[model samples]
Target: MSSTKRLLASIHDVSPRFEAQVDQLAGVLENHLGKGRFAMLVVPDHWGAAPLREAKAFQSRLRNWSDSGIEMFVHGWFHRDTGQHSGAANFKARHMTAGEGEFLGLEEATALRLMREGKALIEDIIGREVAGFIAPAWLYGKGSLAALGQAGFALAEDHWKVWKPGNDEVLAKGPVITWASRSAMRTASSLAFASLARTVLPHALDTVRIAVHPGDVSKPSLLSSIDATLGRFARSHRPARYAELS
Candidate 1:
C-alpha cells in the first residue's frame, strides 16, 4: 500500500424514486467531503418504475451535479434481478442480495444492450461521459463481465475491487465499506463491519471505498454510523475522485 491514502465515496441507486433520500445522503456526504467531492451511481430506471428520461426535474439536478464535477456512473438498468440463475450465479442471486443484482444472470447480448442503453441515457442527460458502470449490489455474472468490456466502459467495481473494463486491469483493491438497511440482520452486520472498518481500513489500504444508498437515510443509526465512518476516514485519507484510480 502507498503511504498516502485516498478515500472514494459514492451514493448508489440514484433515481427519482429515491429522490428525497438521495438528497439527504448527498447532504451527509457533502457535510463531510464538500459538494461534488463524491460520485453517484445512477440507475436509469429503478425497478421499472422511476425512469430518468421522464423525470425532467431530476434530470436538471443531475445536469447540475455533473456540471459541478460530481462524477456519475451508470448503475444497473432496472436494479431488479429478474433472470433465472444457475450455479454460482444462483447462489449469489439468493444469498448475496435480495433480488437486486440486476446483471447477475443476464446473457452477454442482453447485458450489452442494457449497458449501452444506460450509458447513452445517462451521458445524454448529463451531457458528458459517465465514469463507469457498476452493477447493482456489486454483483455481475459471467455474461455481464463479458458485456462490460464490449460496452466500452472505462471502469467498473465489484464488492472487492475497482477495475478498468477496457483492459481488465485492476485499479484499486479493497472492500467497499457500505451499510445495508433493508433488514435488521443486514443492518446490524453492516453497522458492525463499518465500525470495524473505521478502525482498520485507514491503516490497511492505500485507497478506501465507502458507498451509501438511499435507504440508508431512513435509518438514523445508519446515518450516524455513516457520519462517524466518513469522519474517521477523512482524518486519514484525502477525499478522492474515482477517476484518480484510473
Candidate 2:
C-alpha cells in the first residue's frame, strides 16, 4: 500500500476562483494519475447565498476535461455553515451547508428536505445523477447517514475514507492537498509547479491524494510546497484516478 500510485483529490467552495484552481489540480491529477484515474469532489449545491452558480461553473470546466474522464463525487449539499466554523481541525463535525439549515438544531425532516432540494437542483443543472457524496469537511451528524444512503450514493469518503454506515468496509480513501490557510489561491501558478516537484520525490511512494483549497494557489511558498510534493510522489507512482477502480 505504501508503494501505491494513485491520486484522489477532494475540493470545495465552487466559485470563479474555484473554477481556476480546479483546472490546475486537474492537471496534477492528469500528470500523476493519467487516463481515468483521478477524482474531484463537487459542491453540487453551495454558495453561502449564491446557490448552485459556482457548482455549475465548476461542472462546466470539468466537462471540458471529460475526454480524460476524470471522475467527480458530489461533495456536499452546502459546503458552508451548517453549524461549522473554519480555522481548526475539529471542522470535521461543524462544517455543513446553509441549506442544511442549522444542522445541530434542525429536525431530521428539515435536514433531509434541504439536502434533497440541493441534490435536485444540482442534477437539474448537470443533466445527470450524482453517484457519490462526501460531506463538507467529512463531518456529519448521526442523522446524516440514513438520509445520504437513501439519497442513493454508492461510495463515500468520510472521516478517513473508510467504507461505512455499515458492517462492511473497503479501502476507499483519498488525500488532503492543503496548505497553511484558506487564502492560498493568490499563487496558483507557483503552487502548481511546487506540486510537480513533490510528485518526483522517493519518499511519497504510497497511493497519494493531495487535498487542495481555493486558497493554496495564493502563497508562493505554499504553492511551491504543493508542486514539490507532487513531483516527489510522481517519481515512483503512476498517476491514477478513482473512477478507473470503480
- Candidate that would win on lDDT: 1
TM-score of candidate 2 to 2 decimals: 0.67
What tens-digit string does per-residue lDDT give for candidate 2 at 113-176? Answer: 6666656655555566544566665555656665655665556665455353333355554444
- Per-candidate Cα lDDT values, in order, are 0.93, 0.53
Which digits, one per residue and each the tens of the lDDT, describe model 1 over residues 34-71?
88999999999999999999999999999999998899
At residue 120, what lDDT does model 1 achieve? Answer: 97
Q: Best candidate per TM-score, number?
A: 1
Instruction: Indicate the worst ten consecutive residues by lDDT in candidate 1.
Output: 1-10
Task: Quote the positional error of residue 239 for candidate 2 in Å.
Answer: 2.3
Q: Give lDDT: candidate 1, residue 192.
A: 99
lDDT for model 1 comes to 0.93
